[model samples]
Each structure stands twice: as C-alpha cells, then as structure tokens.
Target chain A: MEYFFELLLSGLTRGSIYALIALGYTMVYGIIQLINFAHGEVYMIGAFTALIVASILTMLGWNEIAILFIASVVAVVYSMAYGYTLEKVAYKPLRHAPRLSALISAIGMSLFLQNYVLLAQTSDFMPFPSLIPDLEILEPIAHLITTPEIAIILTTAIVMVLLTFMIKFTRVGKAMRATSQDREMAMLVGVDVNRVISITFIVGSATAALGGVLIASHVGQINFYIGFIAGIKAFVAAVLGGIGSMPGAVLGSLVLGCAEAFFTGFVSSDYEDVFAFIILVVILIFRPAGILGRSDISKV
Target chain B: MLELKNIKTFYGNIQALKDVSIEISEGEIITLIGANGAGKSTTLMSICGIVPPRSGEILFMGKPIQDMAPNNIVSLGICQVPEGRRIFPFLTVAENLDMGAFLRKDKDEIKRDIEYIYELFPILAERRNQAGGTLSGGEQQMLAISRALMAKPRLLLMDEPSLGLAPLIVKQIFEIIKKINTENKTTIFLVEQNANMALKVAHRGYVMETGRVSMSDTAANLLANDEVRKAYLGI
Candidate 1:
C-alpha cells in the first residue's frame, strides 16, 4: 500500500511538470494549428537561464529564497522574449505560407537553438540548485513525497485554476478563445488577432519556463538537451488528451505520468520512455483526435 | 457613409472582386444582390480589410481605409455578420455578444448594450449560458446578428443572413435588419442571394455578376427590372 502511494505521488509530480509544458503545446496548436516544434527549446533555454541566474545570485551571497524567486522571474521573462521573437522571425512571415513551411521553419529553429546553446554553454549536465524550499509541514511523510513534489502539484493546481478563470472571465482570455474559434470573425468583431497570437506565445513560454525551473529543481540536473525529451513527452501528453483542449491537456498529462510511473514501478524502469511512446502510438491509432478532442467537422 | 472606388481583390492568383465601385449613403440600407461566387462576400471582406483591395480605395466616412487591418476597421464602426454565422462555437451566447463589443471599454454601456441585445432577441437571453454551436441554425443567425449589434456599428455589413434558414426565420431576420437600421440610424450594406427579401428591406441595390457590378438602382426599380427579375428573383 505504501509503495502504491509513493508511486502515485511520484506520478503526480511528473504529471504536474508535463501539464505545465503540455499547456504551451495545446494553446499554440489551438490557435494556429501548428505544432510549434521549437517549444521544447524554449523550455530548455528557460532552465539554462534560471541556472545561470541562480548561480550568479548564489555567488553574490544572495538569500536562497530571493535567488529562487528572482531566477524564476528572469527565466520566465527571458523565455517570453524568445517565444515572441520566435513567432515573429520564423512563424509570422510564414503565416500566409503553407502549413508545412512553418513546420519546417520550427524544426530548423529548434536545431539552431540547440546548436547555439551547445556552442555557447557546455553540452554537459549542470547540477541544478535546490530552489524549491523544504517545508517542515510534510517532514513526517518525507519518504512518500518531498517538498518539491508538493510544490509542483500545488503550483500546477493553482496555475490551472487561474488559467481557467482567465479564459472563462477575463477580456484577453475571451479574445483568445474567440480568435481560436474563428480568427476572421474575431477580426470582424475587433480582436487584434496578431496581438492575440503574440500573447498566446508569451503565455505558453511563461508556463513552460515555470515547468523548466520546477523540473530542474526536482530532478537536480539539467542540460540543453533536457528540453528535447521533455518537450516531446509533453507534446505526446497534449496529443493524448486532445491537442486543442485545455483540460484535455492536463488530464492527458496526468494519465501519461501515472501510466509511466506504474510501468516503471512494477514493470521495468528501462522501458519507461518506451512505454510513453507506445501509449502515444496506441492513442494515435485508436483515437487519432485525442481523448477529449472533437473530431474535425467544420460547419459550412 | 462608405464608398468603394474600383476595388479589385484577389486570393493569390484568383481574382475575387473586379473593379467594383459602390457608394453607400450615411442613413440608407443598401443591398448587393448576386449569385453564388459573384464576390459579394469578398466586397464586404475587402471593406473590412480582411482581404484588402488589390488596387482600390475604401473610403469609410471619406477616409481612405483600404490599407487598414480588420480590427481597425471594426474600431472605426464597421462590423460584419459574415456568411455561415461565424460565432465562437465554444463560447457561451452572452460571451459571443461580449466579443461583438470587444473594442468598447465602458462597462455600464456594454452591459446596457447586452441587455438591449437580449431585448432584441429574447431567445438569445434564454440561451445566454449555452455554447453557441449547440444552437439551431435560426438561433445561431440571431446570435450572429445580435453579436454584430453589440458593436454599435455605424455601418453594418451582412453577408447572406438568410442562407440555410426557414422562411419564417428569414422574415424575422429581415425585419430585425430593417428595425436595426431605422431605430439605430445605422447605414447597412447587405449582401444576399435571397434577392426578394433583400430588395424589400433595402432602399437601393446593386447587382453583381462574376465579380463585377453590372447595375445599380433603387431597390423597387431593380425588383421590377426584367433582367434582375428573371436572373435573380425567378419570377
């Protein structure tokens, strides 16, 4: 029973990170119908930025709490800039071009970012500072779950709630939903679609950066290549839930995380990555649109 | 008031509008009647800057706005109730109306306008919480037109409001269009393939064929013309 609970908590931690990253994929895909392959690099860059900032702060003898908070803010801000620029430089010009052209551009951009990071920084795994605080409240169950895992789960819940509220009630959020549903009609009704698209990229990057920082702290190490694997996994989670659905993305991530956790615990840890992909393959074959995805039935 | 001077619009190499010129007076309900693919929707889209005219100037209140964006055009008091009633499928009915007033910042005014919309279409008020896609065709059309009205547009352009609707619902929508114009003192540019209904509601009309404006006259006169009567009205 205790082992089952431990695996469940671990799965929750993994699911939280996947949910955060999956949101970026789902949102960008919802509005533009593009996969945004470079999104993974954004996450990796986020972790690197946080790592550098945290190191500098620590070297300067700053307090641990301040360092964590400041580093996260900087990472999010930097990633947002990268996401905005990525859209403008690569995707914006290709907005009117064929979809495949944009997809290729995204792939090229991912490669460019990876190589740029490798040349600038070491292509090595860096020890991530334990940024998430150790909470005394959960000391009794330390064996079952750590403070970082608790933080991950609680943070994801809060972010999800906040995001749902924004989409349900806020002006910009409604504009986003409106634009995604029918962009031309959104324009007809006075939505600045370009502005909306930019905002989506910014928001997606912000969440992915948060995910990057959290996952890095939890796992205790990160590298430039971390984003590649994490991003593909999150993409699978998003697709498993239904690519364009918000709750679907979160639900998909949880299901995927839990599935992998159980497979690793009872089956074999070596084939865990393989397990995630197998589920993806099975989902694609059985429910190609996704679990919560609506099949394409365009109204005429 | 709106004026289109030699508007030529294209979708890549395919020309959708060809040298179409039109003039809409400030307080008149004008209709553009045409067959399918005659570029009626393209004209409205061009005016809204969705598909900007390739070589023409659209003067909204005498300011050349051919190069503006679609949102800017709406901000300039032009709103389009496009073909197929393009409401946000997942948004609630009230939310759709809110999008119509996307540019307005006055909270109280927006609320009042929403109430006014509910008054205009009481059924929409009943379905305020329902997702737009779940509505029946007639209901969606009502929501679509009501959504445009939420913008309080000076010049309202509608494309095929009567399409794929029952005759009773079509009559109701036309009545609302007429009501909106006279009561709100709004200038309207209506595009429709339902020539008879359009002619009845319009003060003046233009006939478009194969992306060109072939004729223009008073709506009553066009309704009585032999060519229009045979080609369009099926009389």
Candidate 2:
C-alpha cells in the first residue's frame, strides 16, 4: 500500500509537468493543425532562463522565495517572446504552403533552436537551484510526498482551472473555438485569425515555461537535450488524450505519467521509454481518433 | 449602395469572373440568377473581398474597398450568409448567434438584436441551447441568415439560401427575406439557381452566363422577355 501511494504521488507530479507541456502542442494543433515540433525547446529555454535568473538573484543577495518568484516571472516572459517570434518568423510565412512543407519547416526550427541553445549555453547539464522550502507540517505523509511535489500539483491545478474558464467564458476563447471549427467561416464572421493564432502561441508557450521551471526545480538538473526527450513524451501524451482537446491532453498526460511510474516501480526500469510508445501504439490501433477525440467527418 | 466596375477574378489560370460590372442601389433586392459555374457566387466573393478583383474596382458607398480584408468588410456593415449554411457545428445555437455580433461593442444593442433574431426565427429561439449541427437542414439555413443579420449589416449577401430545401421551406425563407428587406430597409444581393422564385422577389434582375452579365433589366421586364421565359421560366 505504501509503495502504491509513493508511485501515485510521483506519477502525479511528473504528470503535471507533462500536462502543461502537452497543452502547448494541443492548442497549436487545434487552431492551425500544425504540430509545433519546437515547443519542447521553448520548455528548455524556460528552464535555462530560470536557472540564469536564480543564479544572478542569489549573487545579488535576494531571499529564496523572492528569487523563485522573480526567476519564474522572467522565464515565463522570455518564453512568451520566444514563442511569439517562433510563430511569426518560422511558421507564419509557411501557413499557406503545403502541409508537408510546413511540417518540414517546424522540424527545421526545432533543430535550429536546439543547436542555437547548445552554442549559447553549455552542453553539460547544470544543477538547478532548489528554492522551495521543505515543510515540516506534513511529517506524517512526508514519506509519500515532498513539498516541491505539492507545489507542482497545486500550480498545475490552478493553471488548468483558469485555462478552462478562459476557453469557456471569454470572447477570444469563443473566437478560438470558432476558428478551430472552420477557419474560412470564422473569417467570414469577422474573426482576425492571425491575431487569434498568435495569442494561442503566447498562452501555450507561457504554460510550457511554467512547466519547465517546476520540473527543473523538482529534478535539480537542466540541459539543452532534455527538451527533446521530454517533448517526444509530451507529444505522445497529447496524441493519447485527443490532439485538439484540452481536457483530453491533461487526462492523457496523467495516464501516461502513472503508467510510466508503475512500470518503473514494478517492472524493468530499463525499458520505461519503450513502454510509453508501446501504450501509444496499442491505444492508437484501437482508437485512431484518440481517447476523447471526435472523428471528423468532412461534408461534401 | 455597392458597385463593381469591370471586375475580373480568376482561380489560378482559369478565369471565374471576367469584366463583370454590377451596381446595386440602397433598399433594393437585386437578384443574380444563373446556372452552376456562371460566376454568381464569385461575384459575391469579390464584393466581400474574399477574392480581390484582379482588375477594376469595388466601391461600397462610393469608396473603393477592393483591398480590404474580409473581417474589415464585415465591420463596414456587409455580411454574407455563405452557401451550405456554414454554422459552427459544435457551438450551441445561442453561442453561434453571439459569434455573429463578435465585432460589436454596443452591449445593450447586441442584446436587443439577439432578441429580435429570436423573434424572427422562433425555432432558433427554441433550439437556442442545442448544438448547431443537430438542427435540421431548413433550421440550419434559418440560423445562417439570422447569424448574418445579427451583424446589423446594411448590405446582406445571400448565396442560394433555398438550395436543397423543400418547396414550402423555400417559400418560407423567401417570405422572411422579403420581410427583412421591407422592414429593415437593407440592400440585398442574392445569388440563386431558382430563377422563378428569385425573379418574383427581386426589384431588379441580372442574368449571368459564363462569367459576365448577359442581360440586366427590371424584374417585371425579365419575367416577360421571350428568351428569359424559355430559358429560365420553362415557358
């Protein structure tokens, strides 16, 4: 029972990070039908920015909580700029081109960003600063959970709730939904599709930055190549949840996280990555549209 | 009022509209009747700035608007009810209506306009919360027109609103169109394949063949012309 609880706690923590990253993939796909392959690099950039900010703030004699707050804010802002620029420079011009061409452009962008970061920052992994204070108030359950794990879960929950409300109740959200349903029709109805697409990238990239900060603090490490593997896993999660469905992305992330945790806990840890892909293949074979995805029927 | 002077549009290498000149006066129902591939729909698309005329000018209220974007054209009070009633399938009827008034900031007026749309199409009011895709074909067409009307457009472009509908439903839709024109005093440009029904309701008629306006006359004159009677009226 104790082992099961430990696995569950760890699974939820990891799943929160995956869920945040997967949302960027899902939303960009929803509006433009493009799988933003470079999103993981945005996450990596977030972590590096946070790390640099923390190191500078610490040297300047800021307190721990203040450093965490300031570092996260700066990282998130920088990631937002990166995301907006990525879309405008890399994706926007190719929008009217063939789907295959756009896809190739995205992969090229992913490679370019990864190499750019490698050249700018060190190729070696750097230690992430642990700024979250250890709480002694949960001593009884501390064996199963940590303070950082609690923080990650709480932040994910709050962000998810806020995102749901915004997508459901706001005007821009309605425009997004409309555009996703039918782009040409949405335009005829007075929607500025370019603005909507840009906003989607901004929001998605900001959330990815948050995920990057949380995961870096939790794992106590950062590297340029980390985004590649993490991004592939989050892509699997998005595919598992129904690529364009927001709630489906979160649910898929949780399922993927829990499956990975249990596999590592009970089965051979050596083949953990293999297990995630195997699950994706099996689920796709059974339901090609994904768990929560509605099958699109083109009208004549 | 709107005017298209010597407008030409193409689909890649093939021309869809060639030297198409048209003029519409305010508070009049102008109908363009033609067979399939006669450039009737292309005329509407050019006016709405979806496909800019390769040459000539499109003047809405005497100002050239050939370079404006589609969304900007809507804000200028020209709205289109596109063919096949392209309502957002997943959105509820009420939500779809709300999207129609997307560019408006007058909150109270938007609310009142919505109420007016409901009164015009009571079936839409009853199915307000239902998903748009689940509605019947006739109902979807009604929602499409109502959605466009929600924009409070001075000029409404309708593309075959009566297509694929029953005779009774077509009559009902035509009655609603006439009511909207007479009551709201809106200028209308209608494209239709059903010549008999279209001519009965229009103040003036233009007969398009291939990619140009082959004939233009008052509705009564076109209804009496020998060629029109034989070719369109099945006399």
Candidate 3:
C-alpha cells in the first residue's frame, strides 16, 4: 500500500509537469491547427534560461526563495520572447501554406533552435540548483511526498485554475475560443485572429517554461536535448487528452504519468518509453478523438 | 455610406466576383439576390475584406477601405452575420453575443445592448446560457444577427439569414431584419438566395448571375421585371 502511494505521488508530480507542457501543444493546435514542433525547444530554452538566472542570483548571494522567484520570472519572460519570435519567423509566413509545408517549417525551426542553444551553451548536462526548500513539516509523509513534488502539484493546480478562469471569463479568452471555432467567422465578427494567435503562443510558452523550470529543479539536472524527449512525451499526452481540449491534456498527462511511474516502479524502467508509445497507439485505435475530445462533423 | 466600384475577387485562379459595383446610402436596406454560385456571398466577403478585391475600390463613408484587414474593417463599424449562422458552437448564447461586442470597451452600454438584443429576440434571451450549437436553426440565425448587432455596427451585412429554416422561421427572421433596419436606423447590406423575402423587405435590390450584377433597380421594379420573375421569383 505504501509503495502504491509513493508511486501515485511521484506520478502526480511528473504528470503536473507534462500537463503544463501539453497545454502549449493543445492550445496552439486548437487555434492554428498546426503542431508547433519547435514548442519543445521553447521548453529547453526555458530550462537553460533558468539555469543562467540561478547562477547569477547565487553569485549575488540571493536567498534560495528569491533566487527561485527571480530565476523563474526571467526564464518565463525569455521563453515567451523565444516563442513569439519562433511564431513570427518560422510559422507566421507559412500560415496560409499547405499543412505539410508548415509542418516542415516547424521541424526546421526545432533543429535551428537546438543547434543555436547547443553552440551558445555547452552540449553537456548542467546541474540545476535545488531552490525549493525542504519542508520538514511533511516528515510523516516524507517517503511519499517531497517539497518539490508538493510544489509541482500546487503550481500546476493554481495555473490550471487561473487558466480556466481566464478562458471562461475574459474577453481575450472568448476571442480565442471564437477564433478556434472558425477563423474567418471570427474575423467577420471583429476578432483580430493574428493577435489572438500571438497571445496563444505567449501563454502557451510561459506555461511550458514554468514546467521546464520546475522539472529541472526536481530532477536537479538538464541538457540541450532534454526538451526533445519531454516534448514528445507531452505531445503524446496532448493527443491522448484529445489534441485541442485543455482538460483533456491534463487528464491524458496524469494517465500517462501514472502508467509510466507504475511501469518503472513494478516492471523494467527501460521499457517506459515503449509502454507510453504502446498506450498511445492503443488509445488512438479505440478513441481517435481522445478521452474527452468530441469528433467534429464538418458542416456543409 | 458604402460604395464599391468595378470590384474583382478571385479564389486562386477562379474569379468569384467580376466588375461588381454597388452604392448604398445611410439607413437603407439594400439586398443582393441571386441563385447559387452567383457571387452574392463573395460580394459581402469582399466588403468585409475576407476576400479582398483584386481590382477596383471600396469606400466606407467615402474612406477607401479595400486595403484594410477584416478586423480593421469591422472596427470601422461594419459587422457581418455570416451565412450558415457561424456562431461559436461551444460558447453559450450570451457568450456568443458578448464576442460580437468584443471590440467595444463600454461595459454598461454593452449590458444595455444585450438587454436590447433580448428584447429584439426573446427566444435568444431564454436560451442565453445554452451552448449556441444546440440552438434550433431559426434560433441560431437570431443569435447570429444579435451577435453582429452587439458590435453596435453602423452598417450590418447579413448573408442568407433565412437559409436552412422553415418558412415560418424565415418569415420571422425577415420581420426582425426589417425591424432592425427601421427601428435602429441601421444601414443593411443583405445577401440572400431567397429573393421573395429579400426583395419584399429591401428598399432596392441587385440581381447577380455568374459573378456579375445582371440588374439593379428599386425593389418593386425588380420584383415586377419579367426576367427577374422567371429567373429568381419562380413565377
């Protein structure tokens, strides 16, 4: 029972990170119907940006909490800038082009960003400073839950709740939903679809950056290639949840995370990636629209 | 308040509108009526900048608007209730209406306008909280029109508001269109395949065929024309 509980806690923490990254995938897909392959690179950039910030703050002798806050804020801002630039340079020009062409452009962007970062920073793994203070109050459940795990879960919950509120209550959020449904119709009714698309990239990138920062802190290390694997896993989660559905992304991530944790905990950890792919294939075969995705019928 | 001269539009190599010219004064209900593939929708789309004219000019309040973006044109006070009642399916009726007023910043005015919309279409008021996709065809059309009106547009462009509805619903929609034109004093540019309803309500009409306006006259004269009767009125 204790072992099961431990696995569940770890799964939730991992799932929270996946959910944050998956949201970027799901939202961009919802609005533009383009799978932004470079989104993973944005996450990678975020981790490195945080690392750089942490090093600077540590040199300045800042407290751990202040260092974490400043590092996260700077990382999120840098990632947002990268996301915006990526969209403008790589994706915007190809907006009206064929889907395959846009996809090729995205993959090209992914490679460009990876190489750029690799040349700028070292290709080797860098140690991520542990900034989350260990909470001694949870000593009773310390075996099952750690401070970092609690922080990851709480941050995800807060972000999700805030995101939901924004989507449901805000004007820009309404415009985004309207644009996703029908771009031309949204334009006819006065939505600047371009602006909405830009905002989507901004919000999505910020969340993904948050995930990158948190995951780096929890794992205590990151590399230039970390985003590629994490990005693919989150893409799997997004598709599992139903590509365009926000709640579906989170649900899918949790399910995938739990499956991964259990597979590694009970079975051979080496087969984790294999199990994740198998689950994706099986789910797609049965429910192509995903767990919560509605199969849309194109109206004549 | 709106003028188009020798406007031409194309979809790739296929020309959808050729030499289409129109002129409308403020507060007049001018309708473009035609059969399927006659470019009536294209004419409206051109004005909205969804499909910009490759040639000629469009002026709104005498300011050249052909080069503007769709949202910019909308912000200039022209709003479209598009064909097929393209209300956001996932949004509640109220949210759909709120989206229509997206560019407007005055909250109290928006609230009052929403109240006015409820008065205009009582059925929409009742289903305000329901998702727009679930509404009946007639109700959806009403919501589309209401959504456009929420923008407080000076010029309202309506495309096939009566499409896919029962005769009774069509009649109800036409009545509302007329009421909006007269009571609100809003200039309307309507496009419809249903010439019978469109001609009856509009002050003037243009007949389109094969991407060009074949005829233009006062509504009563167009309705009386033998060629229009044979081709469009099904007489």
Per-model clash counts, in order, read 0, 0, 0
State the lDDT of candidate 1 residue by residue for A45-85, as single tens digits: 99999999999999999988899899999999999999999
TM-score of chain A of each: 0.98, 0.98, 0.99
The 0-to-1 C-alpha lDDT of every candidate, in the order given, reads 0.94, 0.92, 0.93
The best-first sequence of candidates by lDDT reads 1, 3, 2
Q: Give the TM-score of candidate 3.
A: 0.98
Query: Which candidate leads in lDDT?
Result: 1
Q: For model 3, what TM-score does chain A reach?
A: 0.99
What TM-score against the true fold does each predicted structure earn?
0.99, 0.98, 0.98
lDDT of 1 at B101: 90
For candidate 3, write residues A4-52 as lDDT tens digits.
9999989999999999999999999999999998999999999999999
> What is candidate 1's DockQ?
0.92
Model 1 TM-score (2 dp): 0.99
Question: Per-residue lDDT of A124-227 in model 2, one digit per residue for the tens?
Answer: 99999997877889777889999999999999999999999988889999999999998888888899989999999999999999999999998999989988
Query: What's the DockQ for every one of the candidates?
Result: 0.92, 0.77, 0.81
Docking category of candidate 3: high
